[model samples]
Target: SLGQFAISENGGIALAQISNHYLGNFGMIILALIVIIACLKTTVGLMSAFSETFVELFPKKEYRFYLLIVSILPCIFANIGLTKIIELSVPVLMFLYPLALILILLALLSPLFKHSRLVYQITTAFTLLAAIIDGLNALPASLHTITFISVIINFAKDFLPFFSLGMGWILPSVLGFIIGCLCQITITVYKNKKSSTLS
Candidate 1:
């Protein structure tokens, strides 16, 4: 139990190594961005392709074309990329109440054990501890900002209807997937056929 809680010297060294690996090559960031963009394109292409094939195997959705358009944003959550995006265009997300509620449900249910309060409690506790520690540790040198202001972005908005689930990187991707399925079927079929005939 003690060992489980202890932060080993080896662990610290490994973490430092990992950090260095990430922050080391300046050119690697560009290479990685290129690779990430390539992979996302491949992923979407494959998904659209497989979806096309699967319809022959199984039943197809009525609204597949509209949904694909909503999922155009490239899937990336690296802090480096995110900071760049924030500097470029910090989206003020506003949605209709129904859409907002749907996003909330998509986030909360999340394919995990549905309605499991214990799991939620444990997850929340871990999240809270990490967030609070980040706040405290980042406070000393950046001592100008008081603790009160730090609390807003720190706390969870699990109960709030119109909430920003900032801790998650996957949610936007998943939401994109869902909204894709909901909106983009007809156009996708035409484009799929046109491209298929050419290929």
Candidate 2:
């Protein structure tokens, strides 16, 4: 159990190598099959998700057209080359990932906030600032030939706790939540006073 849990991120590749050590050529077959199945499942999931979102966002568009658009874009990117696509996409994905995670976390915990729009907006706005910096920092040094991103990252690193560990949004998110709660309390008090006066 300990060994299984201790496996690092490259554990699958390590496992495949071990299998090859024990099973020889047959292990390669097993590894290939596993990878192909995993890739196919992921491809299907991504295609379905993108197609559904595209159709829903532009309801007037036919599903076939949306699907084709989804399909062709990947094909074009693939043809342009996978490595190039990844190079261009890494910063974007990095930028988007934090926002996605924060949004999902906020949505899940929204009930705790009584679904307050002020809380949601404030928290998300703060998170957006951190996420943008994180995304730009995700870009390679070659792309950052300009000093601006480096300067922002330096400032964030100095002031934002956990910025080094990719959790820079945590502090801002908490601050936002606190401010939002205060706002809610103030609004509630004002409303109560107005109601009592009217009575």
Point to the candidate with the largest lDDT.
2
lDDT of 2 by residue, 100-134 (tens): 88788878988987888888888888888988987
Question: In TM-score terms, which candidate is top?
Answer: 2
- Candidate 2 global CA lDDT score: 0.80
Task: Please state the error at residue 174 of candidate 2 in Å.
Answer: 1.1
In the range 100-133, model 1's lDDT, one tens digit per residue, is: 4444654677554444444344444433433443
Each model's backbone clash number: 11, 0
Cα lDDT listed for each candidate: 0.45, 0.80
**Cα-based TM-score, every candidate:** 0.23, 0.79
Name the 10 consecutive residues with the lowest summed lDDT in model 2. Answer: 1-10
Off by over 4 Å in 1: 1-38, 45-62, 65-68, 71-83, 86-120, 132-147, 150-199
